[model samples]
Target: MAIDFGTCFTTAAVRVEQAGTAASGVVVTAVEIENSRYLPSLVCLDDDGRLLTGRAAVQLAAQRPERAESHPKRALLRQSAVLLDGGEVATAELAAAVLARAADEARAQRGGTEPVRTVLTHPADWSPGDLDRLVEAARLAGLDAPELLPEPVAAARFHAAEVQAEGDGPIAVYDLGGGTVDTAVLRREGSGFRAVAVAGDPDFGGRDLDQALFELLRDRALDLDPEPWQRLWGDRTPASAHQRSQLARELTLAKESLSSTGTVYLAVPGYPEPFVVQGGEYRAAVTPALTASIVLLERTVARAGLTPAELGAVVLCGAASRTPPVADLVAARLGRIPDLAADPKAAVALGALTDPPAPAGVDTGADAGEEAAQDAVSADGSRRWTVAHYPDEVDPELWF
Candidate 1:
């Protein structure tokens, strides 16, 4: 099993035996439990070293008020702290505690065994040291460290399985999730695929859009209020001083509604009124940033000597798959966009555990399942997430 232990949200999936199957048969699947699937990448700690995860921990924070800490994941990403009953806590410890909780759930679901194999996903451009830290965190969570998977690569597998059923050149994955926007180009190989080139901006994506939305409502200039917004919005990047509050669920809900409907309505608790926003204005506010994102994708396509028309399929991942601007931009640039409504947040986790990357030079016209399972294996036995790049030298744009 592999988990997309995302910063804003987390999901897990596993390869298991097929229902009523002979020992000769098994099906690989990414599984999800009700509400158990994603806990706001948050954790709260107590003096006794008790840890909490998922919705329980989130709720516990409100009750305990002192010992229970929240947003451990955010703390780590933002280099900030939360005042809990037990005193100050580090963000890394928070993430570790969350992972610890996730591991507990994973164990229970998998029959309480440590032999379960797991893969952990990370930003494609994470410093190697950063990956090691995550591995160590997983260890702290009570399981053996899991294999590392890149968010883009997991998304590539999910997307290729969907669109490659019809046609193939290269599969372009635009993964805009709750936390980051990532994009990558994969060429199909005989069995699996390989990333020719990849790029993403850790600082951009849905989280960035959240900041833009907050700025729209806060009535403050980006320069003057940027610090506060950064604390709330840019939690994925390195920063100092963070506010531990979570986004008002209603605000994020309203912002999400604006993605599809022409207008969105929101409530601010302290205000006596609800706020309404027209989608057009929202798009306008974020256009310049998105334009650069499109160009970032174009750069990778151009480098590959393949026109957008030559693309196999554009796969979208992350919670931001619903953002109209991101979808429109992909269509405007790539000529086609794959359907992404299925748990847009968990698609990568699902596919990473079940769907393998398209074979290099794949013919987008065929169904993936029709091909033998043996076809999913790459010559090197590495998933596309094992991107081979001279990270020290290559500085491609950080969005797919």
Candidate 2:
């Protein structure tokens, strides 16, 4: 079994042999949760202290905000305890609850006592410490230490096998998930792939866009009445946190709807009139993140010692990449239309189940300098840390 524990959502898959035959191809089926494959990465406790996971947790957050903990993954790097319902909740504990929920769904789907080997995917540039915490979370979730896979590597593997992308050159992966934007370059090797370069912005992606929209709504709410605003979201009020969570939930739904329409009119509670926002306004709010993602893509290619023309293909991963503005930016900046897998969100988990490439044969005829650089990158992959930089010279306004 493989689980893609996304910041905003999670998915799991189990591999099975076709018709119980040894020679049959492995078929992967998605584990269903709340009658859907996508599970919201949310955790919350009720008034009586009952634990709620996934969509249920998200719903509870709107009604009982103080007890809800959303976006726990973002808290991984912080040292302070997160305030939840007057208590401090450890980041690992919240992550464990979310992961355990996924594991439970998978076990129910399988209906067997067979010991399952689980693979969990993480962001490409996650530090060794972060990886260790993920393993601990899995363990706390009642699962053994899971095999860890980098998100982009797993994505590239899926693209190579499913798309039959035929090329010896490196493939570029543009991963725009709920909480972050990651760009990675991968070259196929014997039975596996080598990462040439990887970079990401933890503050960028769909969640950022949601916040931008939420701010707009908040401003309108304040104008409508500071009293209602204070009652719903003031720091000193009991229902303030709950109201904030409810607003966030509403705006997230509105943000997703903007993809298909010119405007999203919201009938927010306590607001005398509906809030109307144009799609263009939302696009402008998120352009900085989109621009940052393009720059990261360019930086990855340059670090790989290759021009955009030298790239085999640009593969788009994650659900947020489906947004039209992101796709347009990739085409305009990279000068190539990106290829998306069958299901971008599920690709990483599915790819984790793929076989590694066979070891490559030594090439005596290979260019000496190129081989040395490749070897260096491979070595760096096993090291504890690596730093990448985005051009500080770029104007901030250009991002939007």
Candidate 3:
């Protein structure tokens, strides 16, 4: 099982293999929550002390403004506890709640609590402390000591297979997710790849683009009436918080639509009027952040001892990669068209399952904590049957 615990969304996939069949390889299928593959990583606490996850947690965000932890992955970096339902909860615990939801989904999808090798993915540059915290969270969520895989490595592995990518030159992975941008260069090393260099800007991501869109609406609203705009767009007041959630939902939809269309209409919740955001305006809003991501990408490749011309492919991963500005920048900067063959959202999880960083032995129906049969192998000869705890979350538009 591979859990892509994204800041804005979460997804889980399992590799199923038949016994004694090396030719069958392994089949990777997404685990569903409420019949949908991805689950919103939002978490909240109820008045009764119950922890709610995914859609349930998001649904409670408006009703209990202070209790909702929107991006627990970001919180992990701060190593802080967020206020939730009138109390403080540690970030790792919050992450555990999300993982527990994935674990439950895994059990239901696999049909038992069978002992399975677990793999978890994290940002390529996450400190050992952050990685340790996630491991603890997985243990808290009732899973074994999971091997950790880096996001870019996982994405590169997944894309390499899709394109049948080959060469001594490294593959550059540009991962623009909801909360961060992680760029890494990995070259094939025997059966797997090794990370050569990595760089990222944790402060920027798709969320920044969404905020730019939100700010545009807010600026227009302020022009209409500052007093009312301040009431809903400023501070932590309940009404303001609720309006923020509402506007985030609105802009998320608009942003996704803007990816394919020339314009998007946003219905402002706190203001009397709706706004039409042209494609140009949206692109302008995100250009700075996307430019920063590109700069980081350049630095990453330079550090990896290669020029953009030397890269085999510039692979795109994460939901934000689909944004036209980002995709366009990658193509222009690298002079190689960005590969989008895999679903940007699902690529990391697929790669996590395909080419985990560690040599996690296969679990051929092993008992929990006990060894079983030989490892399962993909038809392409990569080791298989590793379960992972990668991060995932819904794209903002999917929350509502």
Candidate 4:
């Protein structure tokens, strides 16, 4: 099982092994929420202990804002304790629920057959402790701890393999995600990807644009619904929050519309006129934030000791990678337009399962009898499920 636990989405793919060495690797990818295009990356355990995921969870959070908590990412950053109905659910546990949902999906695709090997993708800047918690959560959810990998590193490895297979050269990976935009210079290095320089932002993503769009909507919505607008200002209550939710959905629609179209014909419940906000105004308001992200990303590559002239094509993924201005942003920074090879949404998961773990213990020259019974080989030429204990090499305090 190879899983990509993204900020707003999660995906998993399984590998089925075959006998013939050449035909051994087969990749199959699946996602948790098939009904909805977007995975909310949300988990809500209702009063009945029923779990909700994806759009259902997000929808519930919006309806019953008091009982439900959404956007665990912010809480994870604040290190704030959550008081759930049954007990306190740690931020890691919330993330774990989301991840476990992906694992559950993987199991369903494989007909309940347990996966022996697994890999997990995480944000590049996440601390080792953060990685540990993710692994720990997976374990608690009944899956084995996986090989933890930075998302860009995984993407680079995936792209590098494709280029090398086709006899191609250096490439750049422009990973514009919902939460961040990461770009890496993927060059062939030692039969793998050498990320020469990588750049991204911890903040600044489609969500940033959403906020700007909300502000613009507020400017429009107030004129249309001056009564509700006045009611919201007098007090910060559930009614006000509900009104905000209704208004914000319009902004969200507008922001999403900008992905493929220049203008959004938006209608809010309070707003009488179905107004249109041209993409130009939207672009101008969000350029500063996007520019800052692009500059940071470009800086990472520039610092890695390479000029744009020496590079290859750029590859990108993440939910927001599909935005129209994202490629333009990369081109302006790198001075060369890039060739997009993979679907930004599904490519990472597809690539995740391409590489398989060589189960240790197979002896090429072993007798047929010995080979028949052998599972994996250890470095010492023996395999009895050996576990090599390396020094902890990590601070235990951080996990607490």
lDDT of 3 by residue, 35-74 (tens): 8777888888888877789777887897677788888888
**lDDT comparing candidate 4 with the true structure:** 0.60
Indicate whether candidate 1 or candidate 3 has the larger TM-score: 3
Query: Candidate 4 regions off by >4 Å?
Result: 20-25, 36-38, 49-51, 83-87, 161-167, 223-226, 230-250, 356-400
- For candidate 2, write residues 107-164 as lDDT tens digits: 8787864435677788877766666677667777776756666687778878877765
State the weakest 10-residue window (summed lDDT) of model 2.
391-400
Worst 10 residues of 3 by lDDT: 391-400
User: How many residue pairs clash in all the candidates, one count each?
Assistant: 21, 6, 22, 5
Highest-scoring model, lDDT: 3
- When 2 and 3 are scored with lDDT, the better candidate is 3
lDDT per residue for candidate 4 within 32-145, as digits (tens), equals 457632466667767676657766676665555554446555445546457655467777677767777777777787788888877676655555445456656666566664
- TM-scores for all candidates: the values are 0.77, 0.82, 0.85, 0.79
Superposition TM-score, candidate 3 onto the true structure: 0.85
**Local distance difference test, per candidate?**
0.62, 0.73, 0.73, 0.60
Question: Rank by lDDT, descending?
Answer: 3, 2, 1, 4
Candidate scoring better on TM-score of 1 and 2:
2
